[model samples]
Target: RSDRNNAIRSPTSIDMDHNDQDEVPTASLGTWIFLVVVAAVSFWSQATVTEERFVPALNVIANIFNIPDDIAGATLMAAGASSPELFSSFVALFITHSSLGLGT
Candidate 1:
């Protein structure tokens, strides 16, 4: 997901007309439609109202993120979804001087 562009000149083949125009091809129509559908599903399920739907949504996100093992990634994502709870747990442990909530 990184794009590297260098502006330095090379010592070789300088005599040629180095136009240096780059082409960036985009995703095809099918791919775009597929991704749009997937994104719509992901957002639709990121809510508690449709409680039974988020699992597939998270799985799709994991795949789009190039992660292996949908279940494991989904678990990690679920844990991350409750950021406030995590922060609260951390503060409570700190005030109580406990090593709790530190174990993965």
Candidate 2:
């Protein structure tokens, strides 16, 4: 019926007006600059920590295990790089009850 057809709305029926687009919000310049500074500081700290602590710890571990420096470093770096993905998979499987992360 015409009444039912009028009542139903398709995805394309949503407003696409220029005035509405202009009213959409965005982050200010100051907020963007602050985020850049925070990111720079985060990268700097990570580099410093790796240089000062991680390398020395790796050397000690290599010495203890009688493993070559290159092998130990490579193994640890691979584990470190993959840890976020591994943990995300566990979280997706257990907490979120999804297998999406594992497939990724």
Candidate 3:
């Protein structure tokens, strides 16, 4: 058991041991700044697109289907929130034959 523990604590194994606090690694300040800037830009772009295009498209869809605005919005929101998980589950069950995505 001690030999196993020593092997795990060896230099090469240090990289694989996530629980070791003494050798914690982190991204550089520049990398963190770049990530923050990229995230902000992405969020801004998504918000702009949703405001300029998605809302108008949703309105048009509701009008075409004669769906109440609230109902259409609720349905769209629910579908948007669930579709990724549903697709992942299908892929996990059928293509990958794994339960990982279902658990997620």
Task: Estimate, for each residue in 37-83, the C-alpha lDDT of model 1 and write its tens digit.
Answer: 99998887666533666556666777787767756555756676787
Q: After superposition, how far is residue 85 of candidate 2 from its true place, in Å?
A: 5.1
Quote each prediction's TM-score: 0.33, 0.61, 0.56
> Comparing candidate 2 with candidate 3, which one achieves the higher lDDT?
3
lDDT of 2 by residue, 1-104 (tens): 97777578564663432257677899999999999999999999999998999889878988999999889999977787788999988899889999776676
Model 2, residue 40: distance off in Å is: 0.5
| Candidate achieving the largest TM-score | 2
Superposition TM-score, candidate 3 onto the true structure: 0.56
For residues 1-22, what per-residue lDDT tens digits would candidate 3 score against the true structure? Answer: 9888887686867767656777
- Stretches off by above 4 angstroms in model 2 are 1-20, 83-104
Candidates 1 and 3 compared: the better one by lDDT is 3
Model 1 TM: 0.33
Cα RMSDs of all predictions? 16.9, 6.1, 7.3
Model 1 stretches with alpha carbons more than 4 Å out: 1-21, 48-104
Q: Candidate 3: what lDDT?
A: 0.85
Clashes of each: 0, 0, 0
